[model samples]
Target: MAYVINDDCIACGSCLDECPTEAIAEGDIYTIDADACTDCGTCADVCPTDAIHPA
Candidate 1:
């Protein structure tokens, strides 16, 4: 499974650097590219707003 960035994201960029697979990208609210996500859940760990979730 891949992780998705929810609309609650505040673009704090915590998850972007936390992703080991570099699947998360910066955007208006940040986005996770499922193709590259390894489902390691690293990004979700550091998300202060808890916007990253399983997809």
Candidate 2:
């Protein structure tokens, strides 16, 4: 499964840099592109507010 960015996202850009596949996009709360996500969990690991999770 891909990782999903929840509403708790602060849009701090922390996960953006951590995504190896560049699946994350900038937005009001940020968004993870399911098709591009590698399910590596890197984004979730770097999320400051624990917003990213398996979808």
The lDDT values for all models are 0.89, 0.91
Cα RMSD of all models vs. native, in order, equals: 0.7, 0.5
> Which pairs of residues have clashing backbones in candidate 2?
none
Give the per-residue lDDT of model 2 (tens digit) for 1-55.
Answer: 9999899999999888889899988989899899999899999988889999999
Error of 1 at 14 (Å): 0.5
Worst 10 residues of 1 by lDDT: 13-22
lDDT of 1 by residue, 20-41 (tens): 8888888899999999999999
Model 2 / residue 55 / CA error / Å = 0.5
Query: Candidate 1: where are CA atoms >4 Å away?
Result: none
lDDT score for candidate 1 against the true structure: 0.89
2: Cα error in model 2, Å: 0.3
Q: After superposition, how far is residue 52 of candidate 1 from its true place, in Å?
A: 0.6
lDDT of 2 at 16: 80
